[model samples]
Target: MARPKLQDVAARAGVSVTTVSRVLNNRGYLSDELRARVNAAIAELGYRPDGIARSLIGRKSGLVGVIVPSVADPFFGELVAAIENTLADRGYKALLCDCQENAEREGEYLELLQANRVDGIITSTHNRGVSGYERAELPIVAVDRRIAPGVPMVRGDNRAGGLLATRHLLARGSRAPIMITATDHAGNDRATAYREVLESEGLTPRVHAYGYATPIDERRAMVETWLSGRRRLRPARRLPPRRGGAAG
Candidate 1:
Protein backbone atom coordinates (compact mmCIF):
# COMPACT_ATOMS: atom_id res chain seq x y z
CA MET A 1 0.00 0.00 0.00
CA ALA A 2 1.07 3.57 -0.62
CA ARG A 3 2.26 5.27 2.57
CA PRO A 4 0.28 8.18 4.00
CA LYS A 5 1.44 11.71 3.38
CA LEU A 6 1.59 14.70 5.76
CA GLN A 7 -1.57 16.07 4.15
CA ASP A 8 -3.39 12.90 5.07
CA VAL A 9 -2.23 13.20 8.66
CA ALA A 10 -3.27 16.82 8.80
CA ALA A 11 -6.67 16.13 7.26
CA ARG A 12 -7.28 13.27 9.70
CA ALA A 13 -6.32 15.62 12.52
CA GLY A 14 -8.76 18.32 11.20
CA VAL A 15 -5.87 20.75 10.87
CA SER A 16 -4.11 22.55 8.08
CA VAL A 17 -0.85 21.26 6.51
CA THR A 18 0.86 24.38 7.92
CA THR A 19 -0.20 23.36 11.39
CA VAL A 20 1.11 19.84 10.83
CA SER A 21 4.39 21.25 9.62
CA ARG A 22 4.56 23.47 12.66
CA VAL A 23 4.01 20.49 14.92
CA LEU A 24 6.73 18.53 13.12
CA ASN A 25 9.20 21.43 13.13
CA ASN A 26 8.23 22.43 16.67
CA ARG A 27 7.65 25.91 15.30
CA GLY A 28 4.76 28.33 15.88
CA TYR A 29 2.63 28.65 19.03
CA LEU A 30 0.42 25.58 19.18
CA SER A 31 -2.22 25.02 21.82
CA ASP A 32 -2.15 21.79 23.85
CA GLU A 33 -5.36 20.53 22.29
CA LEU A 34 -4.14 21.00 18.72
CA ARG A 35 -0.75 19.46 19.51
CA ALA A 36 -2.34 16.32 20.97
CA ARG A 37 -4.70 15.98 18.04
CA VAL A 38 -1.83 16.29 15.57
CA ASN A 39 0.24 13.65 17.34
CA ALA A 40 -2.71 11.27 17.59
CA ALA A 41 -3.45 11.69 13.86
CA ILE A 42 0.20 11.02 13.06
CA ALA A 43 0.10 7.81 15.13
CA GLU A 44 -3.13 6.59 13.55
CA LEU A 45 -1.92 7.10 9.98
CA GLY A 46 1.49 5.54 10.61
CA TYR A 47 2.92 8.46 8.72
CA ARG A 48 6.62 9.30 8.86
CA PRO A 49 8.08 12.56 7.64
CA ASP A 50 10.37 11.90 4.68
CA GLY A 51 13.71 13.40 5.64
CA ILE A 52 14.65 13.84 2.00
CA ALA A 53 11.38 15.55 1.17
CA ARG A 54 11.57 17.82 4.15
CA SER A 55 15.19 18.64 3.34
CA LEU A 56 14.07 19.69 -0.09
CA ILE A 57 11.36 21.90 1.40
CA GLY A 58 13.71 23.26 4.04
CA ARG A 59 16.73 23.40 1.71
CA LYS A 60 18.83 20.98 3.70
CA SER A 61 20.66 17.71 3.06
CA GLY A 62 21.01 14.99 5.68
CA LEU A 63 24.76 14.90 5.26
CA VAL A 64 27.60 15.94 7.53
CA GLY A 65 30.52 17.84 6.02
CA VAL A 66 34.07 17.64 7.32
CA ILE A 67 36.68 20.22 6.24
CA VAL A 68 40.36 19.63 6.68
CA PRO A 69 43.09 21.98 5.60
CA SER A 70 45.06 19.09 4.17
CA VAL A 71 44.62 15.33 4.53
CA ALA A 72 48.23 14.78 3.49
CA ASP A 73 49.27 15.58 7.03
CA PRO A 74 49.30 12.35 9.01
CA PHE A 75 47.69 13.91 12.05
CA PHE A 76 44.73 15.19 10.05
CA GLY A 77 44.54 11.99 8.00
CA GLU A 78 44.29 9.89 11.17
CA LEU A 79 41.82 12.26 12.76
CA VAL A 80 39.56 12.29 9.71
CA ALA A 81 39.75 8.50 9.41
CA ALA A 82 38.75 8.02 13.05
CA ILE A 83 35.85 10.45 12.78
CA GLU A 84 34.63 8.88 9.54
CA ASN A 85 34.80 5.39 11.10
CA THR A 86 32.85 6.44 14.16
CA LEU A 87 30.20 8.19 12.10
CA ALA A 88 29.85 5.15 9.83
CA ASP A 89 29.37 2.91 12.83
CA ARG A 90 26.46 5.11 13.87
CA GLY A 91 24.80 4.92 10.43
CA TYR A 92 25.83 8.40 9.34
CA LYS A 93 27.89 9.30 6.28
CA ALA A 94 30.40 12.12 6.01
CA LEU A 95 31.39 14.41 3.14
CA LEU A 96 35.09 15.06 3.18
CA CYS A 97 36.18 18.57 2.07
CA ASP A 98 39.86 19.26 1.61
CA CYS A 99 40.70 22.95 1.33
CA GLN A 100 44.46 22.61 0.87
CA GLU A 101 44.97 25.79 2.91
CA ASN A 102 43.12 27.93 0.43
CA ALA A 103 40.78 30.30 2.23
CA GLU A 104 38.78 30.98 -0.92
CA ARG A 105 38.35 27.27 -1.56
CA GLU A 106 37.41 26.71 2.04
CA GLY A 107 34.68 29.33 1.77
CA GLU A 108 33.38 27.71 -1.39
CA TYR A 109 33.37 24.28 0.27
CA LEU A 110 31.34 25.64 3.18
CA GLU A 111 28.80 27.07 0.74
CA LEU A 112 28.70 23.82 -1.19
CA LEU A 113 28.17 21.78 1.94
CA GLN A 114 25.31 23.99 2.98
CA ALA A 115 23.75 23.97 -0.48
CA ASN A 116 23.84 20.17 -0.36
CA ARG A 117 21.81 20.18 2.87
CA VAL A 118 24.49 19.09 5.27
CA ASP A 119 23.09 18.71 8.77
CA GLY A 120 26.41 19.44 10.43
CA ILE A 121 30.12 20.06 9.91
CA ILE A 122 33.47 19.14 11.47
CA THR A 123 36.50 21.30 10.84
CA SER A 124 40.25 20.99 11.45
CA THR A 125 40.96 24.59 10.37
CA HIS A 126 40.21 25.93 13.82
CA ASN A 127 43.87 26.85 14.28
CA ARG A 128 43.51 29.22 11.35
CA GLY A 129 41.10 32.07 10.72
CA VAL A 130 37.55 30.68 10.83
CA SER A 131 35.31 33.49 9.72
CA GLY A 132 33.97 31.36 6.88
CA TYR A 133 33.30 28.45 9.22
CA GLU A 134 31.58 30.67 11.72
CA ARG A 135 29.06 31.81 9.12
CA ALA A 136 27.67 28.31 8.58
CA GLU A 137 24.37 27.64 10.35
CA LEU A 138 24.84 23.90 10.72
CA PRO A 139 26.02 22.25 13.91
CA ILE A 140 29.84 22.37 13.76
CA VAL A 141 32.42 20.58 15.84
CA ALA A 142 35.99 21.82 15.76
CA VAL A 143 38.47 18.97 15.85
CA ASP A 144 42.04 19.97 16.70
CA ARG A 145 40.96 23.59 16.21
CA ARG A 146 38.54 26.16 17.69
CA ILE A 147 36.95 29.16 15.99
CA ALA A 148 33.19 28.92 15.69
CA PRO A 149 31.06 30.33 18.49
CA GLY A 150 29.09 27.92 20.70
CA VAL A 151 30.61 24.97 18.81
CA PRO A 152 32.00 22.01 20.76
CA MET A 153 35.79 21.95 20.71
CA VAL A 154 38.01 18.86 20.91
CA ARG A 155 41.81 19.23 21.04
CA GLY A 156 44.86 19.35 23.28
CA ASP A 157 46.36 22.25 25.19
CA ASN A 158 48.51 24.14 22.70
CA ARG A 159 49.67 26.70 25.21
CA ALA A 160 50.77 24.05 27.66
CA GLY A 161 52.58 22.16 24.93
CA GLY A 162 54.50 25.31 24.08
CA LEU A 163 55.46 25.85 27.71
CA LEU A 164 56.69 22.27 27.97
CA ALA A 165 58.83 22.61 24.86
CA THR A 166 60.38 25.85 26.08
CA ARG A 167 61.18 24.44 29.52
CA HIS A 168 62.65 21.33 27.96
CA LEU A 169 65.02 23.41 25.88
CA LEU A 170 65.97 25.62 28.84
CA ALA A 171 66.58 22.58 31.03
CA ARG A 172 69.08 21.33 28.48
CA GLY A 173 71.14 24.44 29.40
CA SER A 174 70.32 26.05 26.03
CA ARG A 175 69.75 29.68 27.02
CA ALA A 176 69.26 30.93 23.49
CA PRO A 177 67.29 28.03 22.09
CA ILE A 178 65.11 28.68 19.06
CA MET A 179 61.64 27.26 18.31
CA ILE A 180 60.64 26.05 14.87
CA THR A 181 56.92 26.30 14.19
CA ALA A 182 54.39 26.44 11.39
CA THR A 183 52.84 29.75 10.45
CA ASP A 184 49.25 29.49 11.56
CA HIS A 185 46.83 31.70 13.45
CA ALA A 186 47.12 29.45 16.52
CA GLY A 187 50.86 28.89 16.32
CA ASN A 188 51.52 32.08 18.25
CA ASP A 189 49.75 30.79 21.34
CA ARG A 190 52.41 28.15 21.93
CA ALA A 191 55.17 30.55 21.03
CA THR A 192 53.75 33.11 23.45
CA ALA A 193 53.70 30.60 26.27
CA TYR A 194 57.23 29.52 25.39
CA ARG A 195 58.39 33.11 25.50
CA GLU A 196 56.78 33.82 28.86
CA VAL A 197 58.52 30.89 30.56
CA LEU A 198 61.91 31.67 29.04
CA GLU A 199 61.70 35.40 29.78
CA SER A 200 60.85 34.62 33.40
CA GLU A 201 64.19 32.82 33.73
CA GLY A 202 66.11 35.80 32.32
CA LEU A 203 66.64 34.06 28.97
CA THR A 204 65.76 35.04 25.38
CA PRO A 205 63.63 32.94 23.04
CA ARG A 206 64.21 32.59 19.30
CA VAL A 207 61.36 31.43 17.09
CA HIS A 208 61.65 30.22 13.48
CA ALA A 209 58.41 30.11 11.48
CA TYR A 210 59.05 28.71 8.02
CA GLY A 211 59.70 25.64 5.88
CA TYR A 212 57.20 23.34 7.67
CA ALA A 213 56.77 20.23 5.50
CA THR A 214 53.97 17.70 5.95
CA PRO A 215 56.02 14.50 5.96
CA ILE A 216 57.37 13.53 9.38
CA ASP A 217 60.94 13.05 8.18
CA GLU A 218 61.01 16.40 6.40
CA ARG A 219 59.59 18.14 9.45
CA ARG A 220 62.25 16.50 11.62
CA ALA A 221 64.97 17.71 9.28
CA MET A 222 63.63 21.24 9.41
CA VAL A 223 63.56 21.09 13.20
CA GLU A 224 67.12 19.83 13.25
CA THR A 225 68.22 22.79 11.16
CA TRP A 226 66.52 25.19 13.54
CA LEU A 227 68.17 23.52 16.54
CA SER A 228 71.60 23.65 14.88
CA GLY A 229 71.13 27.33 14.16
CA ARG A 230 70.21 27.95 17.81
CA ARG A 231 73.33 26.14 18.96
CA ARG A 232 75.51 28.32 16.76
CA LEU A 233 73.80 31.48 18.03
CA ARG A 234 74.95 30.70 21.57
CA PRO A 235 77.80 28.17 21.58
CA ALA A 236 79.13 29.53 24.88
CA ARG A 237 75.96 29.67 27.06
CA ARG A 238 75.18 25.97 27.40
CA LEU A 239 73.64 23.83 30.10
CA PRO A 240 74.85 20.33 30.99
CA PRO A 241 73.18 17.46 29.11
CA ARG A 242 69.79 17.03 30.80
CA ARG A 243 69.33 13.59 32.42
CA GLY A 244 65.73 13.31 33.58
CA GLY A 245 65.58 16.86 34.89
CA ALA A 246 62.44 18.51 36.31
CA ALA A 247 61.53 19.92 32.93
CA GLY A 248 62.09 16.59 31.16
Candidate 2:
Protein backbone atom coordinates (compact mmCIF):
# COMPACT_ATOMS: atom_id res chain seq x y z
CA MET A 1 0.00 0.00 0.00
CA ALA A 2 1.22 3.47 -0.76
CA ARG A 3 1.99 5.72 2.17
CA PRO A 4 -0.31 8.62 2.91
CA LYS A 5 0.85 12.03 1.69
CA LEU A 6 0.04 15.64 2.40
CA GLN A 7 -2.51 15.63 -0.42
CA ASP A 8 -4.23 12.65 1.14
CA VAL A 9 -4.38 14.51 4.43
CA ALA A 10 -5.78 17.56 2.70
CA ALA A 11 -8.38 15.45 0.88
CA ARG A 12 -9.40 13.76 4.12
CA ALA A 13 -9.74 17.08 5.92
CA GLY A 14 -11.52 18.85 3.01
CA VAL A 15 -8.85 21.58 3.00
CA SER A 16 -6.51 22.93 0.35
CA VAL A 17 -2.95 21.51 0.21
CA THR A 18 -1.57 25.00 0.86
CA THR A 19 -3.82 25.31 3.90
CA VAL A 20 -2.53 21.97 5.24
CA SER A 21 1.02 23.13 4.62
CA ARG A 22 0.26 26.36 6.46
CA VAL A 23 -1.11 24.41 9.38
CA LEU A 24 1.97 22.18 9.46
CA ASN A 25 4.31 25.15 9.34
CA ASN A 26 2.17 27.16 11.78
CA ARG A 27 2.08 30.00 9.24
CA GLY A 28 -0.71 32.50 8.63
CA TYR A 29 -3.84 32.80 10.79
CA LEU A 30 -5.69 29.54 11.48
CA SER A 31 -8.70 28.61 13.54
CA ASP A 32 -8.39 26.21 16.47
CA GLU A 33 -11.22 24.06 15.02
CA LEU A 34 -9.49 23.84 11.63
CA ARG A 35 -6.20 22.83 13.21
CA ALA A 36 -8.02 20.19 15.23
CA ARG A 37 -9.63 18.81 12.10
CA VAL A 38 -6.29 18.56 10.29
CA ASN A 39 -4.69 16.89 13.29
CA ALA A 40 -7.59 14.46 13.67
CA ALA A 41 -7.29 13.49 10.03
CA ILE A 42 -3.51 13.06 10.37
CA ALA A 43 -3.99 10.84 13.42
CA GLU A 44 -6.69 8.82 11.67
CA LEU A 45 -4.46 8.29 8.65
CA GLY A 46 -1.38 7.57 10.73
CA TYR A 47 0.47 9.92 8.40
CA ARG A 48 3.94 11.17 9.31
CA PRO A 49 5.86 14.00 7.75
CA ASP A 50 8.90 13.11 5.68
CA GLY A 51 11.79 13.99 7.96
CA ILE A 52 14.36 13.98 5.18
CA ALA A 53 12.46 16.44 3.02
CA ARG A 54 11.62 18.60 5.98
CA SER A 55 15.25 18.64 7.03
CA LEU A 56 16.40 19.57 3.55
CA ILE A 57 13.99 22.50 3.48
CA GLY A 58 14.37 23.65 7.06
CA ARG A 59 18.13 22.88 7.41
CA LYS A 60 17.33 21.13 10.66
CA SER A 61 16.64 17.45 11.19
CA GLY A 62 14.72 18.01 14.40
CA LEU A 63 16.80 15.15 15.75
CA VAL A 64 19.64 14.76 18.25
CA GLY A 65 22.03 11.84 18.49
CA VAL A 66 22.40 10.42 22.02
CA ILE A 67 25.23 7.94 22.54
CA VAL A 68 25.68 5.98 25.77
CA PRO A 69 27.68 3.01 27.02
CA SER A 70 24.77 0.84 28.16
CA VAL A 71 21.14 1.62 28.85
CA ALA A 72 20.91 -1.43 31.14
CA ASP A 73 23.03 0.30 33.78
CA PRO A 74 20.72 2.06 36.27
CA PHE A 75 22.60 5.33 36.04
CA PHE A 76 22.52 5.32 32.26
CA GLY A 77 18.92 4.26 32.12
CA GLU A 78 17.82 7.28 34.15
CA LEU A 79 20.12 9.60 32.22
CA VAL A 80 18.87 8.44 28.82
CA ALA A 81 15.27 8.68 29.98
CA ALA A 82 15.78 12.26 31.10
CA ILE A 83 17.56 13.12 27.85
CA GLU A 84 14.83 11.68 25.64
CA ASN A 85 12.11 13.39 27.66
CA THR A 86 13.83 16.75 27.49
CA LEU A 87 14.40 16.38 23.73
CA ALA A 88 10.72 15.59 23.19
CA ASP A 89 9.74 18.61 25.27
CA ARG A 90 11.88 20.74 22.99
CA GLY A 91 10.24 19.33 19.82
CA TYR A 92 13.26 17.20 18.92
CA LYS A 93 13.72 13.43 18.63
CA ALA A 94 16.51 11.32 20.15
CA LEU A 95 18.50 8.89 18.01
CA LEU A 96 19.96 6.65 20.69
CA CYS A 97 23.17 4.69 20.02
CA ASP A 98 24.32 2.16 22.63
CA CYS A 99 27.94 1.16 22.07
CA GLN A 100 28.40 -0.98 25.23
CA GLU A 101 31.52 1.11 26.04
CA ASN A 102 33.44 -0.25 23.07
CA ALA A 103 35.82 2.15 21.35
CA GLU A 104 35.29 0.80 17.84
CA ARG A 105 31.53 0.81 18.16
CA GLU A 106 31.56 4.37 19.53
CA GLY A 107 33.67 5.50 16.60
CA GLU A 108 31.26 3.90 14.17
CA TYR A 109 28.33 5.57 15.90
CA LEU A 110 30.01 8.96 15.64
CA GLU A 111 30.33 8.51 11.90
CA LEU A 112 26.76 7.26 11.67
CA LEU A 113 25.35 10.21 13.60
CA GLN A 114 27.27 12.64 11.47
CA ALA A 115 26.06 10.94 8.31
CA ASN A 116 22.49 11.18 9.56
CA ARG A 117 23.02 14.95 9.89
CA VAL A 118 21.75 15.13 13.44
CA ASP A 119 21.25 18.69 14.64
CA GLY A 120 23.46 17.95 17.65
CA ILE A 121 25.06 15.13 19.67
CA ILE A 122 24.90 14.29 23.38
CA THR A 123 27.26 11.49 24.31
CA SER A 124 27.94 9.77 27.66
CA THR A 125 30.24 7.07 26.36
CA HIS A 126 33.25 6.09 28.50
CA ASN A 127 35.32 4.94 25.55
CA ARG A 128 38.55 6.94 25.63
CA GLY A 129 41.00 7.98 22.91
CA VAL A 130 38.27 7.97 20.27
CA SER A 131 39.11 10.93 18.07
CA GLY A 132 36.01 10.98 15.86
CA TYR A 133 34.28 13.43 18.16
CA GLU A 134 37.14 15.89 18.01
CA ARG A 135 36.96 16.28 14.24
CA ALA A 136 33.22 16.47 13.95
CA GLU A 137 31.88 19.85 12.76
CA LEU A 138 28.57 19.74 14.62
CA PRO A 139 27.51 20.78 18.08
CA ILE A 140 28.55 18.17 20.64
CA VAL A 141 28.14 17.99 24.41
CA ALA A 142 29.34 15.41 26.87
CA VAL A 143 27.72 14.17 30.05
CA ASP A 144 29.86 13.07 33.03
CA ARG A 145 32.95 12.34 30.90
CA ARG A 146 35.31 13.99 28.45
CA ILE A 147 35.09 13.03 24.79
CA ALA A 148 37.86 15.30 23.49
CA PRO A 149 40.09 18.16 24.55
CA GLY A 150 37.75 21.10 23.83
CA VAL A 151 34.32 19.45 24.21
CA PRO A 152 32.05 20.98 26.85
CA MET A 153 31.31 18.61 29.74
CA VAL A 154 28.29 18.43 32.02
CA ARG A 155 29.03 16.51 35.21
CA GLY A 156 28.23 16.49 38.90
CA ASP A 157 30.58 17.47 41.71
CA ASN A 158 32.19 14.06 42.06
CA ARG A 159 34.53 15.28 44.83
CA ALA A 160 31.68 16.38 47.07
CA GLY A 161 29.75 13.22 46.27
CA GLY A 162 32.70 11.01 47.12
CA LEU A 163 33.31 12.82 50.40
CA LEU A 164 29.65 12.64 51.38
CA ALA A 165 29.48 8.92 50.59
CA THR A 166 32.67 8.07 52.46
CA ARG A 167 31.62 10.12 55.49
CA HIS A 168 28.23 8.49 55.46
CA LEU A 169 29.76 5.02 55.54
CA LEU A 170 32.14 5.98 58.31
CA ALA A 171 29.27 7.34 60.37
CA ARG A 172 27.50 4.03 59.94
CA GLY A 173 30.34 2.12 61.57
CA SER A 174 32.08 1.05 58.41
CA ARG A 175 35.71 0.48 59.37
CA ALA A 176 36.79 -0.62 55.90
CA PRO A 177 35.43 1.19 52.85
CA ILE A 178 36.61 0.26 49.41
CA MET A 179 35.66 1.83 46.12
CA ILE A 180 35.35 -0.59 43.19
CA THR A 181 34.87 1.54 40.08
CA ALA A 182 35.22 1.09 36.37
CA THR A 183 38.33 2.20 34.46
CA ASP A 184 36.45 5.21 33.07
CA HIS A 185 38.20 8.55 33.47
CA ALA A 186 34.97 10.06 34.81
CA GLY A 187 35.41 7.96 37.97
CA ASN A 188 38.98 9.09 38.67
CA ASP A 189 37.91 12.22 40.51
CA ARG A 190 35.68 10.25 42.83
CA ALA A 191 38.50 7.89 43.72
CA THR A 192 40.82 10.82 44.38
CA ALA A 193 38.21 12.41 46.63
CA TYR A 194 37.70 9.07 48.36
CA ARG A 195 41.39 8.81 49.11
CA GLU A 196 41.50 12.39 50.32
CA VAL A 197 38.52 12.03 52.67
CA LEU A 198 39.75 8.70 54.06
CA GLU A 199 43.21 10.04 54.69
CA SER A 200 41.72 13.09 56.42
CA GLU A 201 40.10 10.71 58.90
CA GLY A 202 43.34 8.72 59.33
CA LEU A 203 41.82 5.78 57.45
CA THR A 204 43.34 3.97 54.49
CA PRO A 205 41.51 4.07 51.18
CA ARG A 206 41.39 1.01 48.93
CA VAL A 207 40.42 1.60 45.32
CA HIS A 208 40.17 -1.34 42.93
CA ALA A 209 39.90 -0.97 39.18
CA TYR A 210 37.24 -3.26 37.70
CA GLY A 211 37.14 -2.79 33.94
CA TYR A 212 33.93 -3.30 31.97
CA ALA A 213 35.31 -6.42 30.30
CA THR A 214 35.61 -8.37 33.56
CA PRO A 215 33.59 -11.57 33.50
CA ILE A 216 30.90 -12.07 36.11
CA ASP A 217 32.60 -15.06 37.72
CA GLU A 218 35.96 -13.30 37.74
CA ARG A 219 34.39 -10.21 39.24
CA ARG A 220 32.75 -12.35 41.93
CA ALA A 221 36.02 -13.99 42.82
CA MET A 222 37.82 -10.65 42.92
CA VAL A 223 35.15 -9.21 45.23
CA GLU A 224 35.45 -12.22 47.50
CA THR A 225 39.19 -11.74 47.72
CA TRP A 226 38.76 -8.00 48.38
CA LEU A 227 36.36 -8.64 51.23
CA SER A 228 39.03 -10.57 53.16
CA GLY A 229 37.98 -14.02 51.89
CA ARG A 230 34.46 -13.69 53.24
CA ARG A 231 31.90 -16.21 51.93
CA ARG A 232 30.29 -14.74 48.84
CA LEU A 233 27.36 -12.43 49.61
CA ARG A 234 23.93 -13.49 48.37
CA PRO A 235 21.48 -11.60 46.13
CA ALA A 236 24.18 -9.03 45.31
CA ARG A 237 26.64 -11.64 44.11
CA ARG A 238 27.42 -9.71 40.96
CA LEU A 239 27.96 -6.34 42.63
CA PRO A 240 30.89 -5.03 44.66
CA PRO A 241 30.49 -4.33 48.35
CA ARG A 242 30.58 -0.62 49.11
CA ARG A 243 31.17 -0.69 52.88
CA GLY A 244 32.22 -3.27 55.43
CA GLY A 245 32.97 -3.30 59.14
CA ALA A 246 35.77 -5.58 60.40
CA ALA A 247 34.44 -8.52 58.31
CA GLY A 248 31.50 -8.88 60.68
User: Of the candidates shown, which would achieve the greatest TM-score relative to the real structure?
Assistant: 2
lDDT of 1 by residue, 150-199 (tens): 77988788888988887887688766766666653444678787767766
Model 2 lDDT, full chain set: 0.81
Q: How well is each residue in 144-204 modelled by candidate 2, as lDDT tens digits?
A: 8877889999999877777788888889977667887766254577887777666666566
Q: For model 2, state the Cα shift of residue 201 in Å.
A: 9.2
Against the true structure, candidate 1 reaches a TM-score of 0.63
In candidate 1, which residue ranges exceed 4 Å CA deviation?
A: 1-62, 126-130, 184-187, 210-221, 235-248
Supply candidate 2's per-residue lDDT for 107.
92
- Reference-based lDDT, residue 58, model 2: 77
Residue 8 in model 2: lDDT: 96
Clashes of each: 3, 0
Query: With candidate 2 superimposed using the best TM-score fit, by how many Å does residue 186's alpha carbon deviate from the native?
Result: 9.0
